[model samples]
Target: MSRLTDLIAQAKERDLELGRELEREFKVLSARRSFGLNFERHRPENVELPGRPLRKGDKVRVLPPRGSTTKGDQRLWKVLRIESENGMRLARLELIGVADPESASVAVDDLVVVAEFRDYIYPGLVSTGKVERGGDKPFHTVINGENFYALEALTYTHRGRIDAIYIDPPYNSGASDWKYNNNYVGEDDLYRHSKWLAFMERRLLVARQLLKPSGALIVTIDEHEVRRLGLLLEQTLEGFTIQQVTIVINPKGVTQGYLSRVEEYAFFCFGPECKIYPGDDDLLTSKDSTTSDDGYSRPRWKGLLRSGDEAERKDREQMFYPIWINPKTKRILKAGKYLPLGEEPDFNVKDEEGNVAVWPVRKDLTLGRWGIGVYTFNDLVKKGYVSLGAYDKKRKSWGLSYLSEQLRKEIDEGTLVVLGRDPNTGVADVVYEGAATRKVRTVWHRTSHDAGAYGTDLVGKLLGNGRAFPFPKSLYAVEDALRIIIRGKPDAVVLDFFSGSGTTAHAVMRLNRQDGGRRQSICVTNNEVRSSEQYALKAENLRPGDEEWERHGICEYITKPRIAAAITGRTPDDQVIDGDYKFTDTFPIADGFEENAEFFTLTYETPVSVSHNRAFARIAPLLWMRAGSKGRRIETLPDEGWEVVDTYGLLVNLDKSAAFCQAVGSNGTIGIVYIVTDDDRRFQSVVRHLPDAVEPVRLYESYLNNFRFSMGR
Candidate 1:
């Protein structure tokens, strides 16, 4: 068994054993009446308040006490107990499940219940510019906010639609690359790995829900967290086929203590039907090729004689055949059918020297077969698809060659012509015509995949400024990975939660342009400033929330600007950098690319006491986005625009229910109709009047349940 499988089996066995032991211990304690020995510690306490009473199992937000050392680390906490201390109510709080070091206690007022893990409503996407080559609507999106909330919002619009996900999350390298709860996590942090795992686990849980059945998730990481991340993915994404691919991002290794690290890893977790598209064959250019035409070199040749087990006649007796050729002209004449053992086929033609031609059989006379069938060989010869190699005079044989249909077409069209003929066999050496495609390998070593060369330098040129984001991924590398997953799926939706520098989205756009596809991308990234940048800003007397500090953050200055520059072929300052990139050149960065993008910031609706009664207005945008964001919105009730329901149908006024239904039935082509009413009678009344074409769905109840936080008021 593989090491990972063996480890999983061992872990299961250990858990089973541990469970049995715990059960036996519990029985012994029950028989000896010792289960109740810790009765004082298990005593329950009741604390009453003016509003909703505090209870166990409720999720709450814990605010640090006035003079505590760990102040301002307000995080989601669970209420463990509620007791009275010195006539004042004190609630015990724990961080999710971890016990507080000092048995943290907070006043009843400070123990606020979490109303919502994230906002039920999100802001509309504001279009910055258009990337013209894409479809009428923008095919790419960038959300500048916390990824967790962004992913949650995506679940409403893109669930079960995204075909691939590529993310380069923080490696947790203890180099201040990431932060937890607004504080940078460093080497000395005790729960660094645990925190990272928890963060990934929650986001991945939501991310998994957003994938189609034939979708894949690709995550890039360094050595510091590869194994742990792999294990975490295995545990969380159960039943997924997980694979690890080693990527050589940095050729010149980064020096550490003893070893210089050069390689990182990409973890691919896919569903059952997920198939990778083998990229074009031009990627497999041989080292000896001289000139490349249109980003591809000449097609390399392979031997026609079949090798390995399949070469034996027993594997397929029909494939065992002979190919005939003219002795002087070296042109293929005919291919002979299958012959039994010890049987020789007759040839009609003879050599110019009056020598009878020989069949292409092994000297040992073993029953070996040709790579293709006899009929296939005949068809290839008829189309001049065969080439000849140097003659083996001692063995009285000549090497046979087969050309692909692409090569044959190229030769026929005169685009690829016969340069010369072989001196010995008189076979023509033809120039290759079109670019061929081949399957991508697991290990990538192309110069275009280099991080520093393509990512840093190319982005620097596009931005027309020297301020480069730290360790951005190579755009070509991301494109190649995505191309493999989204090869045949042109209209597939792609998502990236950790969309640093917006490379994934940029790659998606490039791939769409190359293939004339309409694939879309949704990128989610936070606006937090990097630790290095933050320190430098602080040294310059700029604080975290200051306008200057916020303006230079990763999401604001880096990711958005980079994507804008890439699409428009210009820097943020409108300086043109849209032409071909001179650094390690290939394709034009801005040619044929549309400058289309929508910038959105996730925010909570005002007056955040979001109960079922007042959630309709807050969740309208969420429902609109869920309906593909394809229609116009009807702001006021009884408006003339209500005559047309473009994408989504919403009804808030019960008095105009009949008119709304009549308008929808007459002129609307909506997919779903959301009816808002506190009374079931009114809901059913509206539903009964709606047409059968539109799906009638009741809002508020499910919305409240979905968005309500498990916290005390």
Candidate 2:
């Protein structure tokens, strides 16, 4: 265990029943980051509001309110007033526009206040996923392979508590690859790009609320949408700086090369101090590690090291200066000392004329004599520093490389550089080859590292499906990038929202296994759409059992089952790969969108009630299920997007009550419930929250707003 891990060990191992859930939330809050959140943190910072109270050193979102309007959502002010009634002020207000202003006070309802703190809490092991409402154990579900809209559905369910996220959304393409709410975004549709942007924007907006102050976000993108992605990021994410990484994936060039395509950009937009698990600059990079032919590591420098002054003297006080030395190695002294580097002998001098008797004296010190400082060569060797092993009269250049190698060998053989050194690594470039050279420059390797084949094989096995999704990410490539970011930080939460074939999840697990680190991953995939267009090439007609199996295949069990296998360390039933993961298919609650504690308390509709389908699981409570159960369920995540089922008011968001409304039927039963109200049309369908109807509810309004505005009707 590392020092950081050791410090956090008790916290990680702590049991979270309820208060503990709130407690561990700080850690989660510290961990989770969203894309726009990073940019917001980095961009010109402004004093803003967080959903909660501000603490010192907290990163707050600032909104300048000098020329603000009365028709905007002043949510922070309202929440503060509600908080202030209890005689406490959490938000610090600033009135920048009111011409040398003091706190601008207009309406108690609309005074824009700046809140500084942000934190997210959850109930259990359940990350961002679709949650069910009633009873226990999932009864039935909507099996989506992609589940693209599930997170949107969940925003209402698990509202107000997401910290960080990474998404790889579809770039608009017509090859049956990308989808918008289950519909393909073919190239022919002019609004395809717009639709995709809207879909992403809604998710980003809601994602903002889910982040803590110190959180960040990462989104993956390709060339197709890079142009619009910039604008979309600007509009949706608000205050953040965009960072783009170009990964050279395919060096072989495209099939039809207008230009042999070799690289694709991974555009990254983030907040200040946002970091993925990459190696920090403070740590030495592998490029700095170099070894030489002499089996010794040495610093690589450019230009040349010309010899300094070479005057010799009995009392050589001028030449002695302090030099930095390695202290770690204990010297294996053999009754010897270091030698001084040999210098060029002036052919005219008596020392070179083989006259030990006529050695010249210093002109200034020795009273204007015929030569420079005078001393024998043996006098300089006793200091145990400089080396003069061999000096050729032919070549005046010193063997610098040879000397560096000799020093390295000496250090390796217990020759201390200066004072005896403690084991430490700092203040040097890395030696790449054999740890013998100098600092490595950029542009060394052309082809990037990718494990696409391994990912393809993994996907093929667990789900027992081949070519389920096209062009899934390479497992190794993802790890390579993550390894760059997540250096030395063992326990990290890796998230990938656009999980086409579970490559990100697989890489995290593989890296964890490789390094013996306890890293975890959260991969989200929408139950994608599959066309039933018959294959004209198939020979046989469908059989009786085959028809039923085909019908059953529509369920979203394939992808989730495979990912679960990877997590729990169970062999995927597929034959292509033998590796395992601990996971299960989390079916969404298909029934009961109501708020009825009564069903559990008083009423017994059936032996198994509708509420069983809707109990959203949490992450902390689901550790037991993570022990490789094939069909196990996880615990509920708090304030997540989920539906409440029952008779009373259907709580759309566990946090935002205004997002919900109720309507009662004339027959005294549930007509319908409005879980989604951010949209206008949803109001008509909402059932009144009368105690009689007992209607349950969850909504997709926040998600729908992105698309609703585009409707022609």
Candidate achieving the largest TM-score = 1
Where model 1 places Cα greater than 4 Å from the true spot, the runs are: 1-135, 257-259, 281-437, 539-542, 578-587, 606-620, 631-646, 654-669, 680-695, 709-713
TM-score of each: 0.63, 0.41
lDDT of 1 by residue, 298-401 (tens): 44455566677667766777766666666666656677667775665554446575444435544455545677778887776555556766776554556666
The whole-model lDDT of each prediction reads: 0.66, 0.37
Among all windows of ten consecutive residues in candidate 2, which has the lowest summed lDDT?
595-604
lDDT of 2 by residue, 524-549 (tens): 55432244322211113321123332
Candidate 2 regions off by >4 Å?
1-148, 153-164, 181-183, 255-257, 280-448, 451-468, 483-492, 514-519, 532-558, 564-571, 574-713
The number of the candidate with the highest lDDT is 1
When summed lDDT is taken over every stretch of 10 residues in candidate 1, the lowest stretch is 39-48
